[model samples]
Target: MRMSIGRRLSLLIASQLILAALGIMTSIVAFRRLTHETAYLRHYVFEPFVVISSGIESSNALFDLLARPSSDVAYDARRPMMELRSFVEQYQRDWLTATSTLPEALHLRAALDRAGELGLLNEELAAVDTIAAVVASLERTTGLVGPAPTAPFLRRADVEDLGAALAKLNKINLRYMDVAYSAYDRNRRLILLAFLSVCLAGVAAASLFGLAVHRAIVPRVRRMVTAVQRFRELGTYEPLGDWGNDELAVLAHTLNTSFKAIAERDKDRDRFLAVAAHELKTPLTTMKGFSQVALNQRHDAAVRDRALAIIDRQATRLARLVQDLLWCARISGGERPFNPQAIDVQELARRVIGEIEPVASDHSIRLMPRGDAHILGDPELLEQALWSLLVQAVSVALEHEPVLMTIDADSAGRELITIEVRGGKDLPEDLDRLLEPFAVIAFEGRRGEPRGTGIGLHLVQGIARLHGARFSIERRPGDIMVFSLELRR
Candidate 1:
């Protein structure tokens, strides 16, 4: 699919934003996980250890009171014994609550069950119950003691049993702490690893994306820039290679098309200058030679007259050539001044025929006048265009051949007037080429008359355009070359 430059850049930016968002989300999730883990260690591990340690202290005090003589018991043993029982109960409740409330703890319990080690948790709870039972038994034994001095109420066997239960509970609490610490350590490492992996993946992805985008866009831009710079410095266009269906590609195509056109124009300009120089040189050379001959004192009167006449004719041809070149320049520069007014087409044709008749003495110029037609146009430019057509027709016509000029209304019922010139000669097969400036047309029956400057028909075409007329030439029946102008009435 063809993507424009705008869309490509937009995608690049959007992808980068998406990656950044992912990284931020990963950070946020990792932070929440670590925070939960820290809370679990405090609630379920460290707090339980403190409660168990306090219970052990209370148990020791009770045992010591029982061991002392009843008279030496200054503090109330009942209060201490009751406190010990409450501590053991609170520890058991807190352990169960912490495990149930924490998601991590629940997952750990499920995992332990899967591993066939579910009794690990049950053992801890049972040990807490056992300690509570032993404390309640001691509390009852102490209450039964009389206020008078007596021996310790706890039997020796009961004291040993209570010590063993306390020892087992402490051991269980230590095991639970080990399990909590081990899980925390393992989880902390895993979370850190996941966070690092996400960060690295994001960095890698961003780098690759940047590289891909740079390769896609930067090199193509650089190539276009280089081509423009080279053309500016050397006046030569180098076409760029096709990249893809993107904006840069379209720009390259447009630049290539424009460069090709400029190159063709440059070629045409060079060819025109060469042809123009030759055309101007020819008449000037003739005038120079004839003027030298006429100035020679040794020449007879008749010879001098002949030389002067030749010089005059060449000067006239030179003047006409210069005029045609100037007209072409003016029209091309869009500076040709137009003075349009209503003109009688038939009268204008007669005036043009009269002017060209003297110069085309070898060819008989005839005007086949039809119904009267009038047009709104620039009189001088229209006259010049008609004169060029007539001159061109006469130049190619056989000696004494009839050259026909006609001005009439269009037969097709359209509000148009056609001015036509037909000569008894075949035009060049490439008739369209003649419309271009300096396109030479070589007719088969042309005499020794000087070849045309070739700008005549071009000027005629330009003048016709300025007057909003259509100018064309074609071969007709009877091998006649027809030059035509169709203008609005």
Candidate 2:
């Protein structure tokens, strides 16, 4: 099947939308993971390590008090000062190497400087030498009375300066951690929101695609199939039913056009058959009459009787053929007029069965009335449809074939009448077309069967419709053709 452009575009759009949805989902997950990692790196890693750097700096004052580079204090001080330098270097190196990005190294540098300026370095050598003089005075107290601690040289002012600088650096590092977490949280939320929006859009688009695909494909195929079935069974139908202006619409238009052309051509053919049947009927009747007159004067009894029988049989067959043709023409012309009325159902069934009684008896087929019923329709047309059904049934049942014909009406006092005709020999599968005026289908029959082209049922159906009746068919073991007249009341 050739897909419509709208369907192709919808598919393309749907595929793109699905991909976009997946992309959004991936982004949301990745962003969330990144944000979580950033939080961990800031608080668990950077924040803790920054505080470690501050601790490493604060420990420096102990080393400063021990470091006297001149006399006796140098030996004791050098060991402690060297240990402090190793500790600071190790912690700072760990902090620096653990992460390459972010401001850890910068914070470490500022922390080291603050630790140094806090009476641990000379202002003469940028505070280092001042710390040296204090260390020398404390270490060289060989003869001080009461050991007065060699006059304290590490001043409170130096400690205060280091403390203030450390506080400022710690605050800055705390702020950096806070900002990093805040930005991560914001970006994570953004990705999550975008994912939700994309999901909603995808769902809506999928629903629309489903509806559009259904509308574009299924109904047109159904309509065309239905029309063809009706045309095959009833020989005619209006095929340009309900459809839009898409390809489906174009298909319906083409179907209606083809059927219209077929009907027109059929009409022309029926006209010709009518003229031809009439022309043949006159000569056959005349020849039968002249031959019978000569048979009446014959002295040879056997010869004359055979000729007379042949003439009579030929004349009857010719008349029946002409009548069938005439009926087809009248039906095709839509000219089967009848008076409509509210009819008693029981009486209508009796009347139809009564009309077919002679033929049924002749063919040895039984006509059974099932129940009494009423309908609002033309009694004449209703009887005709039933009578046609019975006639077809009897004709088929003549070879000792058992048959059943039934009639009834629906409930609710709706005046809906029904007629069903059944035969012993299973009916032809295409028997539904038997009622179609110009649509003749052949069925197997016994020898000496009456010549017919399957037009009687067609005429009955046409007349029934002319008076507001519903025609329906069911093919069972034997064909069941039915007609129902809807109550006017």
Per residue, candidate 2 scores C-alpha lDDT tens digits across 389-468 of 55555554435555554444345444444434444244456556555555443334454323334466676667656755
Please, what's the RMSD in Å of model 2?
Answer: 14.7
Residues 1-489, candidate 1: write the lDDT tens digits. Answer: 656777767877887788788778877887887788788778766776687677777767767766666753434576666667678667665565324555656855754555456677777666666776676566556653335334436655655666677778778657666666677777788878887887787777767767767777798889888888888789798988865688878888988898887777676567667766866897789889978887884458998988887777667667766877888889889998998898887788888777666556667777776665777788888877777787677666655778777666766522232333344344457788777775665444343434554577899889878977788877767666778877776
Evaluate all candidate structures by whole-model CA lDDT and list the values in order.
Answer: 0.70, 0.53
Clash totals in order:
0, 14
Residue ranges of candidate 1 with Cα displaced over 4 Å: 1-94, 97-102, 110-123, 135-264, 290-317, 335-489
Task: Give the C-alpha miss distance for residue 454 in model 1, angstroms.
Answer: 6.1
Which one wins on TM-score?
1
